[model samples]
Target: MGIAVTAPIILGLTLEHLEVGLALCFGAFWCSPSNVSGSLNHKMKGILLSALLIMVVSFFGGYLHYKTWLILPVLGFLTFGIAFISVYGFRASLISFSGLLALVLSFAHTSQELEIYQYALLIGVGGLWYLLLVVIWHYINPKAQTEEILAETFILTAKFLETRGQLVGQQTNREALQTKLLNLQSELVEHHATLRDILIQSRKSSGISYYKGKRLLVFVQLVEMLETAIANPVNYEKMDVLFKQHPGYINSFQDFIFEMAQQLRFIAEFGNDIKKLPKSKELSICFEKIKEEVGLLKTSEGKADYEDYLMLQNLLEYQEKQFNKIKKIKWLLGNPDMDAKDFIDRNESKRFIVSQDYNPKVLLRNLSFRSNIFKHSLRLAVTVMIGYVVGNFFAFQNPYWILLTIIVIMRPSYGLTKTRSKDRIIGTLIGGAIASGMVLLIQNPYIYGGLGVVSLIIAFSMVQRNYKASAAFITLSVVFIYAIIQPDITAVIQFRIIDTILGAALSFMSMLWLWPAWGFLEIGKNIETSVVANKDFLGKISHFYQHKGKVPTSYKLSRKTAFLETSNLNAAFQRMTQEPKSKQKHLDKIYELVELNHTFLSSLASLSSYIQFHPTTEASERFKMAITKIDDNLSQVITSLNGGKSQNMASTILQGDVFFKEQLAHEKLFLAQEDKHLERHDQEAHLVWEQLRWLYTISGSMLKLTSSIDFD
Candidate 1:
């Protein structure tokens, strides 16, 4: 609003009043969309760029400088360049829009042009105003982005726990939990994107971790298991038995889920009041159950157990590990360390939009998006073309109406198209009716300027508030503008209505003809490509680890590749989910796969980190050799996956304890060979080979696990 006022003022100061009006109208409407999605920095830069570009384009195009319809496309090309820099491909609506806006305004009451110098003066003033308003908005709410991030992150954590909780109980719905987990993972990605932005602005850590992440991942796995069970509910009794057999684990899971929900609620409030949760009663109960249930499974003379009882033992261990991680987090900045502020800086923080991928293609569809690109584009183009022709024919008598028709009709989203079309028609009609009444009721009017201000208010309010209310307000304002402009009331009102109807019809028809391009499909495919790249990186890591001790640059690249891949896929999915009709089975699967892939890779990374910290020694060389050999087999699995080959584990590998013992024998033999070889005065070389072999075997297996998750 300030920009609209100040732009004309600056122009009026530099040139003529008529020139100031054109400059104000052109610049104000040219870059009008509220840029709530972008940051303060982004909005500032984008508005400036948009203001400059529109000034240059509208200036050339406004004075009828081009006889041909080249101006719109040229404007589009410039907008695209701007979008490339700003990263707003879909929301920006480039060339088609430029023509649509300028033509409608020009065709309507003849628009006066600004002098080039006047336009330049207004441009600077308008840009500054835009910058000012955005700054003021931020000043009122500096931590808006941070709060949004924290809220989203907390929501996902609760969701993860809920899904996992169901998996633990006897009467739990497995299929629903699996779907819930996929949804949770999708939320996690969105949270991360938000976190990246907060990190960029305020270096706040989003408390995600190896254990919690893996828990969610494993939840999905359990859901997968449950889904299989759901398909055969006849085995309900058996499933219930499995649940009863692990009461300790089930109780712990419930406690974890409940605790997580409480934590999330706190975080979502964006408050630093960490909960002093009571000591988990689940732990005490679980200990009692373990003594009774598992004790029965163990033989009198040996540490033996029923298979389910053994599973219970493993489950307990997992619970403790999870709790420990949570405890560690509780110890660190659980109170939101204010001192951490001094450590944060703008440039050092990562931004939300920063990623390995950007979707630029206008014709791509998001995941599971059913809308066909070429067909949709063709349909829209034809409709828009029809609008253009119809608009031209009607413009001679009611040029303003003709342009409005086209602009009102060209909606990208079907629902939005419907709403906007109806609103434009109504607003125009109301404006016409108001114009007719005022011209008839009053003798003279100089109210157009005041009405223009009212129209601006209505436009801004309606855009963010309710669509219908906004349209109604705009209609009133437009009618007011027309009545105050001149005394020829009846003819002008009728003319205005006709022009609007024609413009509306042209817009509606053109959309039916020429197809608007999509930006989702290209993004989706690119996301798929990233996933492939991630798998390759993991495979390379596994294979390379088999040959070296220190992680090479190649391994770092692989880790970076994994991060990049997930980010790309997640972003594409986020866009898809934003559209209506996105909740479908295919989308669910894509999301699930994304979750699965992230979990597997993060685990491998975490596992690798663990290995780096803890090294082997001569005192435990025998066990080290055994573990290394086991890890080697995992490496073979990675190679198979990388080459797109089938994985066929020998049954012996699945023999568990027996197989492990046999591998230990091999490790001992290798260690003995190394010891003897080192004694020959080549100790350093032998030690180097030992370290390399350790890295190759252990790291290789971890990488293989990462790849297999993707390959499968």
Candidate 2:
């Protein structure tokens, strides 16, 4: 904001009108709020990339505006390329920034044949000014931004944990809890992506000290564990039954989880100076009480009760491990010199090299009709062409605003497009009113400039956090820029309001009718993808166990991919909820499918957690058969999702296989012998059997879920 407002004002004194102001404001907008963090080198690279792209886009955009004949094909191709490459991370950010700047600049400037070069240069200059400001900002405190972003990641995780704790309450609304969890999952996915970038940047950065670098590496490990630990939390209803007589234990357990979250948040807040933080003794005490409660129930319990007790034991142990992990992170935060290489290597660490993949083959693959990017690109092209022609015919004061709005507002889905349209319209009206009132009351140029600067800063800060607020401030800043040029602010506000509504309407209609992609149809594919990812992850874990050596790179990659795909699936489910009920066919089946997948993953995590403790344990043939059957069932389920025949073949794999019954009989015989020998229950044996039971349950759940869906 300082650079945007000050550079323009500083140059405006020498230049003619507020053209420099508009150019600088947009230049700053396109360059600000970068995902790349840490070193000045990376920051400058991002800024220069944006500037170069802006220049090229601006040059071609000028011609497309002048020669109406070329607008459709040229802009359509650009849209297709930009939208297709956006599937890769970080590329979308730069592409949108360049595209928006070019669209706005080319139309706003009345380009003369010889002055076209000057126009592109002006845009580059504006971007360079922003780059300079950003470089200066980075040097001021290079580590501060990364630290703040890391803090936000922790805070968001805490919020997600707190929401999960709410699910444990007996009186809570199940649907509401599920909805909140989905929203939190979506948000956490976004935060994880941002944090991944920060970690990647820090790893590549030569700017920070070795202490800071290792700390960043440890943080990366910490966040990855966080995802797994919380992935499939204990069922609240089961816990409720376990604590039927003593609900206080349930409350204490919930509070303990919440306290653990608070400790994480404190670590985020205190950073490297965490000595003053209060230790959480409540969790330890609660664990003891729960232990006592379980012991008391043991005397009156049956075999089922004993099984529940074992499950509870596992749950308490896992929670304790998580708590200790948090404490360990806090310790690492304070003592950054501690050797973290082993911890990092165990996860198969890789260096972060940030670069865009503009390979021709990748782009060509995405051009297929089946690609969502291709469909979205075609939709955007049609909408923009229509919007531009209509705006030119009507001769709105700022006709480019219509094109810009359509570009920003039109998403691939109706739900997103409608949501954006509402936010855009509401934000525009509020901004227009605020700007008009400000112009009426304040006549001082300096004050107007200052407020605009502040508004820009606020908007940048809130862009990722809150879009509606960001939009409002964006409107105010843009209007202030116009106010500096035009005497009558009313006309500017009126034109902005009308242009926004028109653009939003066009975008909404286009998304609703043009290449419409219904959520239900796409959701099945997401489910299949998630299942495949989970299967790969499980296979990798099994290989790791059998090898009994260093954890393989495939294990880590599969784990990350599985979680990422799950997040994507969750996002699709959330979007499906937002679409019209009529369009949301088999909603219950989709919901059930998602829930079953989550449950299956969590069960896998439970198995993996045990394997982490006993990596050398040989798998029984029974366990192997169960996994094989589950894998086969997953394949069948995927085929069914893709509209294949159901085959009506019930998987009696678990039901007919005598492995589980034989295992249970063997355990009983062993326990009977142990009773005679006055021995305790075998912990490792119990864990293996528990995991086997969970696999069987997941298999049954999958079968039920597949039955619920209608492929026809």
Candidate 3:
């Protein structure tokens, strides 16, 4: 907003050139969403690179303007190439977007420009102005980004804690609570990515203060502690069974969680300026109450099952340690001089890394019409050309509107395209109505121009956050600007609305009927990938156990990949649900698959958490065999799903061996002995049993999924 208001004044740019500059600003802003607190140097470099690309695209677009026949083919290929390359990553995608927009804008106004290079130069200058404003804003409010990060981290942690509180009750919907927890974990993973960016920026840039770096380090440590707590959250269902006879203890535990959540919210509110840590004795009291309840059970005539007692004891001890960690974190937050440097260990984040073969030969070898991105690019090219030809045939006042609408509204997936189509139409109608009213009543050019700038500022600001609102404001800004230059807006608004609708309908139709990428169609492949990743993760887990629970980087990476792949599978299914009925396939089975995948991961996570705390060298031979069998079954299932030559093991894997159940029962009997004490490996063995049970269920689910599909 500040950039839009002051860039022209600062750079002495004329309003005509400012429009080009504003376009560059808008492109840069859209490209780098959620990066307000990122390093000024990176931000500036990105915009400058985007600006240069735009200049080159614009220059070539202008040079090719006179060749009327080449325009469609050239622009089509340009759009196709740019959109296809977006398969790489966000930064690369944004750079591609800038180039595409440059081509579009240059193609539109090429005939009017006497010197094409000057117009391209003006666009570059405009990008530079926006870059300057962003840099200045970062320097002026250096702590704002760090503060935002802390606030988000704490808020998410609070929400997760709240979910944990809810899950403590037997009456709670475990599936729903589990879903919410998984979502929160995904959000935390996203936060970790953002924090890594901030840390990297701090390391490279002197603009960040030492105090700020130290503070971020402390928050990073706090986040890691929170992660450990959230990730290893007790299987509430198990806790419910343990506490069913003593609801009082559960209530007290809930109270502690509630207080902890409140404490986190307060920290979020204070951020770096916390005067003193919010005091809370509720957790301590709750801990004592739980201990008392457990003691009473031990003294009762109807003695509690020793295995249950051991489980409860382990949980309570974990909670006590977690409580102390939270209090210590609060104390550190309150003391600004605490040595967080020693505790800050930044893990390299791979959350947003999309692996793509950039080598031309490799890309060419892999390239085919079957690629979704390639097909999407082709669809876009055809749609844009159709829009252009249709508009020109109809003698529309602005043929470019039709092309622009197609460029902005089309997506690879039917669901996204359908959504954007609605937003574009609704936003255009509203903006047109408002602009028409203002144009009919007001004749002041200055007022109209100011309103235009204000609308432009708002549009750019909200573009990343809310596309519908941004579209409306962008429409209003464009209309007002047109009104200032060309006063007759009745025809303009009518043309704008009609052109937008036409283009949107075309784009939507294209996405729906032209090489549409239905998630459900590819869900089998997604499931296969997920199963393979989880298999690798299970292998790593097995290796960790074999090596006395040492978590190497490779194990962590495999775990991360498994979780991320599951999340992706979940997302694909979710997107499929929102799509048209025609796009939704194998609905019930897909839902079950997604649920099973989620449960599988959560179950493994529970086991992993316990194994980390208590290294177990005594995992029974049967337990190891169970995991190996599950891994083999997973590979077989993936092969079946992919239509490879594999025999159906549905009946084979569905039937669990008595050995696993016997081993688990034996462990329980040993733990239940009156004089037997709680051993570390005993708890580990129990968790292994629990995880095996989940894997058995997952195997059954895989059988059901494969049965439902007609792979033959």
Candidate 4:
């Protein structure tokens, strides 16, 4: 981004065509945000589309600027049209933002030396030049992004594990821990999506070279590690009770989990440098301590406490599995030549990579009052037009600054727009004050220009990661740029602050009154989608258990869908919390639903992971019955949320509990025989039966909750 912005200024200075250079720089600056992580093909398409949109908007914006009567209608239409493009997906949203930015800036004719067409042409060239640089950088370090993202994934997973470890302590607030887990899961889901895009697309484009294959294997391990961690879900209440009698056992397990998290963080920190990679800690000692503690408990309590013993055993098994996953990741990192053919085939791999729907029908379908994006587009257009009118009424210099603030601060949701408005106001004020001090204290055009360039670079880099800081730098950059040309820098700074404040106030009000889409109004759909995904995931797990072969792509796809939908639900609930208390209808019920959905997914992960690893009995009739009941419950939950009459499953639930208890009792009889070495099938059946019973119980709870809530 720095290179893209500065190269134009340097060239313009050398040729004494500073306006032309700044025009190119403006084009590059607008396009730079779209230069995000993705496949080479995706990146190229986004950048190219952004460049085209910018050029088109620039030309029209300039052509329409002088027509006072047409300005309002054209501005409204252009804003709505540009914002509507976001219906396609994330990259499209960024491109749409770039286009809106260009449109607003088009009204500002800084160069009397160049024609509108010439300025547009220069900006387009700048965008293309940036694209060229991006391609070169991509080719030069193709794997760097993948590695860095993967490393971040490791760190997040570690935090997740660490949070889970906290649940082992009896003093911890289970609700708080669960909230933290949900938040971490959200972050991990995004990282996983990005990895799928990078790793899957890279393999497809370049074929599976050794390094790519190694990275793919490591990614696979990271994903499975997350599943393993999720699979280790415990009944914190049960754990707390157990802690009363076996505190040492619980503490041992907590320490072991923490140790695992530390190891993961170490790998994240040094995994890129093979020579500096830390050696895996020997956890066998920790494992022994846990085992010894459990052993003593078993000895003291005998078979009377077999259930508690089994819980500890299950915890140990999950810990061991997670440890092995970490080890496998380390090995894959060390041995780059390891075969990747055993992993998902190339064609099958593409199924996991989410592709954007570019069909025109998608856009048409969303162009309605019912569509959130449609409403957002309309709101944005009206708000931007209002900003323009206010700016003109006040006769503020650079009236487009108000439009720019509206464009940048307003979002699809009230919570986001409110937050961004606050950040923008704060950042603009601070940045303007500092810049004003600098301009007064120092009178060097050279230094101002240099500072502007540096500020622009930092602003661009921090836009996604730190919006407040990014806003500050952006203010500094803009002020410094104007300082170089305009003598009354103080006026420019004052107008910038006033424009931002006015824009933010207008944006906040617009979201509240302009056909607002409250989070509660949309959260039910998110919950329904998540439940449906979980239902599909359960079906896949049942099929996998019946077939018992290589994990199918369909199974993986269902798991991905479940994870993503759950993340969406979490995000929706968060947004709801940030809205007006009155608008946040049924906040408690919605939160409960979110928690239940997340727990259900985690439970599914546990069942899926166990079947994938340990031997299990064939999908028996009883297992099928349990799965059927669970599936029906989830389906009914969806039906209720969608405002349909759902069938009562009270009798089925009662029958399921009785049947499961009877089966568990029968299975335990075999294991209760101290002298008898139970066959492997009996042991497996015992574990699978336990998981089925737990899932059935949880599903019933979800059904009950949904039935009581008024989704409308």
Candidate 5:
């Protein structure tokens, strides 16, 4: 961005075409946000699309700026059209943002038709220049972004595991820990999505090279580690009950989990330099300590408490599996030439890369009051037009500044828009005050110019990471730039604050009144999707158990979908809480549903994880019945949520109870033996049966919960 902005300035100054240089800078600055991390093809496509849209919007905006009577309709049409493109997905949304920004900024400069064409062309050229620089940088360091995202994923995963460890300790607040886990899960889902796009798209475009393949393998390990962690779904209440009789066991497990987290953090810290990757910690000692505790419990309690002993053993085994996954990741990192085929098939790997639906029909389909994006687009257009009218009516110094604030602050959701509006206002006020003081104390244009450049760099870099800080730097950059060009710096600062507040007010009001799509109204769909994903995940686990072998790509994909949907549901619930209390319908019920859905996913993970690691007996009749009942319950829940009548399935419920009794009787026979030890297969089968029964019960609860919710 610095290069893209500065190079044009230098050329313009050298040629005494300062306006032309600034126009080019505007072009680059508007398009740079879309040049984010992705595969080369995606990066190129996003930037090129953004450049084209910006040029077109700029041309039209400039042509209509002085046509007073036509401003409202043209502005409304362009804003809606550009904003509506977000239906294509995240990358498209960024491009849409760039276009909308260009439309607003275009009104700031007046030009004849010829001058407009020249400015628009120069802006397009500037976008192309930025694109060129990005490509060069990509080639120079293709792996850097992927590595950085992967490193972040490792860190987030560590935090997630650490939180899970906290959940194990007796004195910790489980509610707080659960909330922390949810937040971490949400962050991991986002990072994982980005990493997936980078690694998977790169493989599709450039084919898998050694480094890409290795990174992909490491990513798979990280994902498996997450699933494995999720699979260690310790019933905290039960754990507490057991630990009351056997203290220090919980501490040992907690320490072991923390150790795993520490190992992951180490990997993240030194991931870029494989040679510096630290040696694997001796987790075996921790395992031995825990094992000794479990052995003592078994000896002291005898066969009467063998089930508890098995539970402890299962927990221990889960940790060991987690430890092995970390070890495997470390080995993969150290061994660069490791075969990618061992991880995922080249031909089948494309299934994991989620592609956006770029079909034009998607846009037309979303052009309804029912569509959230459509409502948001319409809201944005009206708000921007209102901002324009209010600015002109008030005769602000730069009416377009109001438009700029509107464009930047407004978002598709109320929570996001409100948060951005507040941050923009607060940051602008502080930034305006600081700039006011700086201009009063300093009189050098050179200082202003340098500071403007520095501020622009920081603002650009921090936009995604810290919006408040970015807004501050953006204010400073704009003020300093105008300070060099305009004499009345005080008015610029004053109007900046006023315009921002006005635009924010317009945005907030528009979101409130213009077909507002409250999160509660839409959260049901999220809940439905999450439940469906969990159902599919359960089916996958059932199939995996029936056919014991390597975890298929389909199973992994289902797991990913389940996790992602649950994360989305959690995010929606969070957004709903942030919305107006009056709009947050069924808040308590929704929270309960969200928690149940999350726990169900964890239960699925536990069942799947156990089957994946341990050797289990044949998929028994009782197990099949349990899985069927759970599947029926989930399907019924989905149906009920979709406004269809849910079948009671009383017969299936009765059969499941009967099967459970038979399985329990069979299990007791093994416990009655003097040896108090069952075959490994018998033990695994019993655990798997228990997991299925547990899932069936949860699914029944979810079904009842769904039926009780007043979705309307």
Candidate 6:
């Protein structure tokens, strides 16, 4: 509290009121931050860094007799350059913007130097008060943050599961869920980075059991599958049986997730109630069931280890209890969704055909952090503005004045840009108006004291509440200072309004004109690629279904092809949603493909997994060669499907058509000519021929669909 109280006074003496406005500008740049929640380590570093920067400016500005206002601009540019790498992109933004604001508002004023004792008391007191509030709030009730994050993760997982359930060949909707799932990687990244912030109790966070990690990994794998299906439509026949069985075996998995969600809400309702803890072994039971099912079905090459399995199971149990405790109330029934088969069922759907010989591993794409060209351009433009302006202003050197600067820059997506811009303008305008009015009233000391107290209350309340509200109070504080001290209201209001409006206008225009956001065309192109790939995947599947004897790998290749296509579609659709509202309707239409793609792929994955697991053990070579041929054809089809614009894909296709195989290769098949004993040939050959004809018909229809969509 003492530190909080003294902070402003020291600031006024050392920076805002510096003899040269230039030195004050540097100090002001350092002073204006809303520094509450940063790591104690980071905050200490910030303090040291700011002091060092100020000292540099003071030496030159004081010796050169440069005004604080003018010299401050130089410090702003210099600080941004020096701190950009160290501070990180967003923090650097704050420092850079603050410096520019000081220069813009430069007025002739000199600050008196503060004694060391006074300086220590002011900053130290103010900071301590804020720190106490933060520490208490965090420690007294800490579970809320963790529960909220868990809820978010669960919901996201549920959405992906929904998408996976619909992938190619088994359902009405293909790739319908792809778009939504693509955003998972970004969210995952954010969650990973701020795990500590999301969960207050470090000990409890570490308690997460092994099963929980595996479950998360499973979810990640599911998303990977969803993305692939979107990129290329998969052939269901080639899919492993597990994919098909999953939809049924794990029916309404999301409902179970939803049950877990109930705890998330309770934190608010009961304030960390103890009774709410999934007081029973329900989560443990759930994990046990999951493990049992995995074992029965032979998941992940029929060899999921007990160690990892049990660990994951324990983690789930732990989360269940923690999740319940967060809400504060107890639920007697727990989850009604828990059922008999959820624990016991092994999918009766078609099984896989594991070969005696080894099979190759499947590799799904991973999340990447590639640099975006457009973002780079935007960053450059913002930096240029910070540099050019600071090259100009300086008056009596006062660094603390930097704290008063108010300018904003932002992107429309995060809600930061609009909120900051509005507050910056409103606070400046209103503050100036009040300042103009205050100078006349400053003659009375009681009135001045009362006003200061009111300002303090507003600052505390606003600081505890929202950023914009806090900024508003800060603006008022600045006005109060000038008005009570100078006793001139009208001129202050006029100039303050002018400066704020200018800053806001400049920011808006710059963001609007430079490297503007892209529109729907790019999104459309991306969707087209996915759709086409899916179509091609369907064609290969058609081929596999028709030709069963020779090429065994046809079905497997088809599923993989589908997975790749699905990936591309999901990514494109995800990108589209972040666009402005005007582009949303079209993007939504395209995003629907994500769900469709997911359904298709899961079915295919199930089939592929099943086949890989349970290969009909007869002659190995004959079947293997046939499978290889089919796989080759599928690879070519996938390549053709993904050919974005103009691709000459003739050479990439199967060398000789199946229809022409007997004719071109001179293979002998027992055939009865139109006059051959009037259909008296052997029944087996006749049956085989009829079956073959039906397969070709189905295959032809699929090919037509696959080749239909042209990306361009």
Residue-level lDDT tens digits of model 2 in 107-210? 77664433666666777777788888776776797677778767777777777777776766575587787777767776776666655555555555543356
TM-score of each: 0.55, 0.89, 0.86, 0.95, 0.95, 0.45
For every model in order, what is the number of clashing pairs?
Answer: 41, 0, 0, 0, 0, 127
Q: What would the per-residue lDDT of candidate 4 be over residues 1-712, giving only the tens digit for each residue?
A: 8888888889999999988998898888788868788788888989999999898888787787555557899999999999999999999999999999999988776567899888888889889988999999998988778878888999999999998888785864778887888889889988988988888887788777667777777888888877666666788788788778767676788888888898888888888777766565556678788878776655554654666776787778788888888888888777755677676578987888888889999998998998999999999999988888888888999889999999999999899999999999999989998999999998999899899989988887788788989999999999998998999999999999999999999999999999999988889899999999999999999999998989887898999899889898998888888999999777887787787788888888978877887876667787787888788888888888998867756776677678778877877786677443232546566667777777888888877788887867
Summarize candidate 6's per-residue lDDT along 269-347 as a digit string, tens digits. 4323444544435434554555465454433432333333333333333333333332222331233233322321122
Top lDDT hit: 4
Q: Per-residue lDDT for 70-154 in model 3, tens only?
A: 6778878878876776665555566666676666666455434346676667666656656676777777986777777768887
RMSD values for the candidates in order, in angstroms, are 11.5, 3.4, 4.1, 2.2, 2.3, 15.0
> Model 5's lDDT to the true fold?
0.84
Model 1 lDDT, residue 360, Cα:
48
| Model 4 clash tally, residue pairs | 0
CA deviation > 4 Å runs, candidate 3? 1-6, 9-45, 64-70, 107-114, 163-183, 201-255, 281-329, 344-358, 439-442, 618-620, 648-656, 672-681, 710-712
Per-residue lDDT value at 284 in model 6: 43
Decide which is better by TM-score, 1 or 2. 2
Displacement of the residue 606 alpha carbon in candidate 4, Å: 2.0
lDDT of 1 by residue, 519-555 (tens): 3333335444554554555455445444446755556
lDDT of 6 at 125: 38
Q: Write the per-residue lDDT of candidate 5 for residues 646-673, one digit (tens) a residue.
A: 7755665666667767777877786566
Error of 4 at 225 (Å): 1.2
- Ranked by TM-score, the better of candidates 1 and 3 is 3
What TM-score does prediction 5 earn? 0.95
